[model samples]
Target: MLVDNHCHLDFPDFAAELDAIVARARAAGVSRMVTISTYVRRFATYRAIAERYHGVFCTVGTHPHQAAEEPDVTAEELVELSRHPRCIAIGEAGLDYHYDRSPRDMQQAVFRTHIAAARATGLPLVIHARAADDDMIAILREEMEKGTFGAVLHCFSSGPELARAGLDLGLYVSFSGILTFKRSEDLRAIAADVPLDRLLVETDAPYLAPVPHRGQRNEPAYVAHTAAVLAEVKGVSPAAIARVTTENFERLFAKAVAAEAEAGAA
Candidate 1:
């Protein structure tokens, strides 16, 4: 089965037909999805979505863009919220200098909080690095020295340098619909170089739809297209990519997988 390692089912865009969207994903072989949290204040919305769908999981953290708005976020707060059985990861948090949506220092501060939470809880952090790759890499490197944390560079669009930094630091790299773009040859090259165990695929739904669906809203169901392209780039069948990446997902998010395994065993 396929899995959209990351998505935002809690967003307003899918509110009207959330059920149908999830159903479509199941039909497309997407067995599970992680509905990402962008704002800590509305984490309940994400929790509700995860509760309603067995195949859906969720993360708890603030996005970089919302840093200023969530200035009081603390590592302890994220760790506390992550106690929920449905919360499998610590963040969609990191640097995003591309938009300057929040002050750079604020973004860095919030990102550090997320790193701390991930380290404390032993959960994988869902990272989002944008144009400020150098700063992002620098912070990640410094943080690694302080204490290592499990993390994945979600929807990676940064240059080779950043990808190398992430890989060297022992963070997994996830590809999105962006890999299907014709001009993403360089991205594909980078994808090719990522170790098999460290590779992942995501749709980043309601955004960055693949080539055939470019400029349109994306969904977890479309992760297959991205996976197909990734398989092509890696010179393997789509099914191989599916199996390996799904295994990688389970390995990285150990607590979630262990819970699911126990349930099945029972």
Candidate 2:
């Protein structure tokens, strides 16, 4: 089985036919998926998806692109929302200098808020860093000193230095469908260096679909293609990559699995 460690199933692309989307993911060997939250104001929409599908899980966060819109979202509010049994992680939050959709300072502030929430709740943070490697690395280092927190450098396409920094901080690194692109040879080199136990795979679906499916709407089901690419880069069988990454997902999101099991028993 494969676990897509990050995706956005609640997006409009799947809203009208979410059941079929989930079924297709399962049929494609995607046994589990983590639906990412972008805007806190619409988190309930994300939560509803998780509630409806046994294999679906979610996070509560404000993406950097939406940071300006949610400037007042306090760490306490994030911590409170994180108490939901279905909410497994703290963010899809971080710096995004690529677009600068939000003010840099505001994005940093919100990222710090999410780091606090992750620390408070003991859940892994899902980071979305882009074109702000130095700042992201510096903030992550500072926060690590203040307190320990779990985090994943989601959809990593950064330089090897940032990857090393994140791994040094004992955080996991997740590869998205972007890894499957032929132009991602440098990225693949970085993937090869990352230890299997610290690695994860995701679709970031409704977004970066892997090759053969590139330029199309991505889904959790396409993770297998990324996995195949990662396996090739790491010189391991796709099954091995699947097992390692799935184990990493369970370990990093331990609370989510436990919460889901408890809900089942209830």
Candidate 3:
């Protein structure tokens, strides 16, 4: 089974058909998914989705782009929200200078808040870094020195240095549909060198749809294509990639793992 470690199923793109979307994902071998939150103020909506779906889990935090709007979301607030069992991860938060929708300083502030929540709650942080590797590395190192926490660099497209930095800090690196893009040879090369146990796969879907599905809106079902491409890059079968990433997802999201065990035991 595969787990989409990151996606935004609550977005307007999936407004009318979560049923069909989730069904498609299951049929394509994605048995689990984490519907990420873009704003903590809307966490009830996120929690509702998770509660209604058997295999879906969620995170609670504001994205970096909206850092300006939710500037005061505290680590205490995040930790409290995370007490919900289905809220299995801490954020899709980090730096995104590509759009600069929020000021870099504000983004850094929000990112630090998320890191603190992760540290406090012992949940893995879902990091989203773009176009700000230097600052991202500097901040991650800064926070990491204070205390260690679990994390994954979601949809990684950064320089080799940043990738290495994340790995050095014991953070996992996840590949997305971007890895299957026509000009992503460089990314594939980077993917090849990463330690197998530290590599994960995702479909930051409704966004970067992989090849063959490149022109259309993406969904979790398309994670298969990205995984296959990743397998080719790593010179293993897709089933191997699926097994490893699923294990990695469970390892990082310990709450989800425990919940699954409780359900089965029930």
Candidate 4:
């Protein structure tokens, strides 16, 4: 089964039809999904959704855009919140120069905090980077020097240099519906080169829906479209793509896998 490794089921857009959305995702062969956290304060919301759905999981962190709002949120706080049985990762946090909603310095500080949380908790960090490639590369390199940590460049849409930096540092790269756009040939080329073991697929739902479903509100079910396109780009069968990405998801989000195992045993 395929896994939509990253999504936002807690978003208001899916509020009324949350159950239907999960059902549709399962119907589409999406056996697991992680409803990402954009604000640590909303950890409960994300956790509740994860608790409600059998195959859903959650993360704990603040998005860069909301960095300024929770500037005081500490790595300790993130680490503590992540102890929830369903919370599997840390931070959709990083630089977002495109929006500049939070001061660049504040964003970097918050990102570092999340990185620290990842390092301490041994949970993968879900990074959100945009138009801040240089800083992202620099920060990742500098942070790696400080200590190694697990992370994924989620919804990646940056330059080859940033992608290369992440890969070189042993970070997984996740592609969203953006990978299926006609104008994303460059992105497809990048995806083609990413090692299968380190590749992941996501919907980034309520946002970048793939072609044929473009302009529609996205959900976990639509991850199959992105996976199909990725298979074409990687010269593999769709089933192979599903197998590789699901394996990658379990590797990167091991806590989710362990949690499932424990639930089954019980």
Candidate 5:
């Protein structure tokens, strides 16, 4: 079985056919998925999605674009909300200079709050870093110095410097459907360097759908396409890539694995 380690099923894009979307993912061997929280105000919506499905999970925190609107959100708030059994990680949050929707300093401040929540709750932080690589690297390094916390660079599209630094900091790196694009050879080169134990795969749907489904609204089912490309990039069989990433997902999101085990035992 495979895990689409990051997704956003709570988004309106999938609202019309949520059941069918998840059903197709199951048919594609996506046994579980984590619907990322782009806005903490909608954690309830994410929680409901997790509760409605057997294999869905969620994270809690704000996206960088919405950081300014919810500037005062604290680690305590994220920790308390994460008490919900469905919550497994913190923050699809990080710097996103590509859009600059929020002020750079505000994004940095808010990112730290989510990082604090991750450290406080002992949950992995689902990060999204874009064109702000230098700041992203600096913040990650500074934060690690303050105190270490688990994180994954979701939908990775950064350069080799960030990837190497993240690996050195013991952070996991996740690939999205973009890995299957025709001109992502540089990204594939970086993927090849990431240790299998620290590797994970996601779709970042309903966006960045892999080739063949490019320009289409993506779903968890398409993670297989990215995984297949990742396998080719790493010189392994698709099953091996699936096995390693599934293991890495469980290792990082231990709470999700625990919840799944409890449900299985029930």
Candidate 6:
């Protein structure tokens, strides 16, 4: 089975067919899906979706793009909200210089707040980085020095240096559908170098659909295609990619794994 470690099921694009989307994902062999949060304010919506779906989980945080809108959100607030049974991670948060939708300083502040929440809660942070590799690396290194936290570079399309820095800091590297793009040979090279245990796959759904589905609305189901390409890049079979990524997902999102076990026992 495969696990889509990052997606936005709360987005309106899937509203009319959310149940069908989850069903399709399961049919496509996606056993789990982490529906990421982009706004801490709308966390209840994310939690509701996670509760509505059996294999779905959620996170809590403000995205870099929305940093200015919720600049005052604190680590304590995130930690409190993340106590939900299905809220398995801390963020889809980090720097996004590409859009500059939010002030850089505000973004950095909110990002650090999420990191603190992750550190306190022992939840893996779902990081979203773009066009800010140097700052991202510096902040990550500085934060690691302050204290260790579990995290993954979600939907990674960054340079090798940032990848190396994240791996060096013991963070997992999660690839999205961008890996299947024809122009992504450089990304494939990075994926190839990521140790099997440190690699993950995501869809970032409602966006970045893989080949054969590119330009279409992405869903957790298409994570398999990204895994297929990653398998080819790693010179392993698709099944191996599935097993390894699922294991990596469980390890990184250990809260979700424990929740599943608890539910099974119940």
Relative to the true structure, how large is the alpha-carbon lDDT of every model? 0.92, 0.93, 0.94, 0.96, 0.95, 0.94
Worst 10 residues of 1 by lDDT: 255-264
lDDT of 1 by residue, 1-266 (tens): 98798999987889899999999999999998999999998899889998899778999999999999998999999999999888999988998989989999999999999999999999999999999999998999999999999999999999999999999999999999999999998999999999889999999998999978999999999999999999999999999999999999988988778667766788
RMSD each, Å:
1.0, 0.8, 0.7, 0.5, 0.7, 0.6
On a 0 to 1 TM-score scale, where does candidate 3 land against the true structure? 0.99
Q: What is the lDDT of residue 200 in candidate 4?
A: 96
Clashing pairs in 1: none
Q: Candidate 1 — which residues are off by over 4 angstroms?
A: none
Question: What's model 4's TM-score?
Answer: 0.99
Writing each residue's lDDT as its tens digit, candidate 5 over 7-67 gives 9998889999999999999999999999999999999999999999999999999999999
Count: clashes, candidate 6: 0
TM-score of each: 0.98, 0.98, 0.99, 0.99, 0.99, 0.99
Candidate 4 positional error at 61, Å:
0.3
Itemize residue pairs with steric clashes in candidate 3.
none
Per-model clash counts, in order, read 0, 0, 0, 0, 0, 0
- 18-65: candidate 2 lDDT, tens digit per residue: 888889999999999999999988889889888888878899999999
Q: What's model 1's TM-score?
A: 0.98
Q: Which ten residues in a row have the lowest lDDT in candidate 4?
A: 3-12
Instruction: Show model 6 residue runs off by greater than 4 Å.
Output: none
